[model samples]
Target: MNTANPQLEGLYLALAAMNRLMVEKQLLTHEEIHETLAETEAAVMKNSALDGQSDSHRKAVAFPIRLLMTANEAAERGGEPTFEDLARQVGRTS
Candidate 1:
């Protein structure tokens, strides 16, 4: 889906609501949320520079979300999960 598409606004809102709920329920810490957002923004910026890109922002946003999902899944599987793990999963090595 296009990240800038107005039709997807509701989806973004819903996801934001769910994240807020997770914070309220202590399912995610404030630091984790902040780091997640930071990583997302970074992905967007990185992907935005692509030439002839049609949906760079959407693709960029998906990168971090995918990383988050992977980290969550790993954690659920009793594996060690960290922001670095998510970053690595998203190919954000430095």
Candidate 2:
């Protein structure tokens, strides 16, 4: 989206890399991460501050959640999945 934060791109990639590391190292299960992602999505969706925001504003805020969700999906499929792959899969293309 045009509202996407350019600076947060790194954070998105970092999240993917961290996910790969976590899975490779057996630090967390995919299901655990998915559960946490769901919890985060729920909490954000319930935030009062988001109630009056425009769609673009809300999507900007949801970028990280979308990234993680797609990244997790890619991981479930097998092999190393980068954040860029997740981004593309989630239609985050520039």
Candidate 3:
């Protein structure tokens, strides 16, 4: 990742580092992160949070989250699909 795109790699690393810092500072814990992810997955799975979001907004948020979730699952099974593969699998393109 750092080899293909330093800027993107830096951003990802920085965000992860910040998240780790929050845990180190006791501002948040992995348990809280897991809970949030579960709650978000529930809401998004049912599209229960579309009350105020426009269709475009929902797709914008949903697509990426869905893509990442799919990737995460695939990773658990020792799969490493490229971003292009993930996009197509998720029925999305940019």
Candidate 4:
């Protein structure tokens, strides 16, 4: 797949792997990750609005949180989903 930046793709992979390990190690539950990401997304969206950021900007800023949330959801479902899978889900559910 094409990406604007390769570094960003690497970052996403690293983050997803960390999240999976965290869940697997029982360091943090999926519910906790989901809740935290939800709260973060809300805060980012609100800040974006208050700062008069564009809709696209808001979505861009929230992308990582949404990706993590998607990963957590997939983990909760007992599936080792790919970054692409989580990314697609994030796009669909955004």
lDDT of 1 by residue, 1-94 (tens): 3346645545444554566568668899646866776687566656665544556455555654665555544544556455455556667532
At residue 86, candidate 2 shows an lDDT of 62
What does candidate 2's lDDT look like per residue over 20-56, in tens digits?
7897799988888888987886776667355776656
Shift of residue 60 alpha carbon in model 1, Å = 9.6
lDDT at 16 for candidate 4? Answer: 71
Q: What is the lDDT of residue 15 in candidate 1?
A: 57
Clashes in model 1: which pairs?
none
Please report, as a residue range, the 10-residue window in candidate 4 with the lowest summed lDDT.
1-10
Tell me model 1's lDDT, rounded to 2 decimals.
0.57
How close is every model to the real structure, measured as TM-score?
Answer: 0.44, 0.71, 0.48, 0.88
Which ten-residue region of model 2 has the weakest summed lDDT?
85-94
Compared with the true structure, all predictions reach lDDT values of 0.57, 0.71, 0.56, 0.83
Put the candidates in lDDT order, highest first: 4, 2, 1, 3
**Predicted structure with the largest TM-score when compared to the true one:** 4
lDDT score for residue 42 of model 1: 63
In candidate 4, which residue pairs clash?
A: none
* Candidate 2 TM-score to native: 0.71
Q: How far out, in Å, is residue 14 in model 2?
A: 1.5
Model 4 scores a C-alpha lDDT of 0.83
Which candidate model has the greater TM-score, 3 or 4? Answer: 4
- Which is the winner by lDDT between candidate 3 and candidate 4? 4
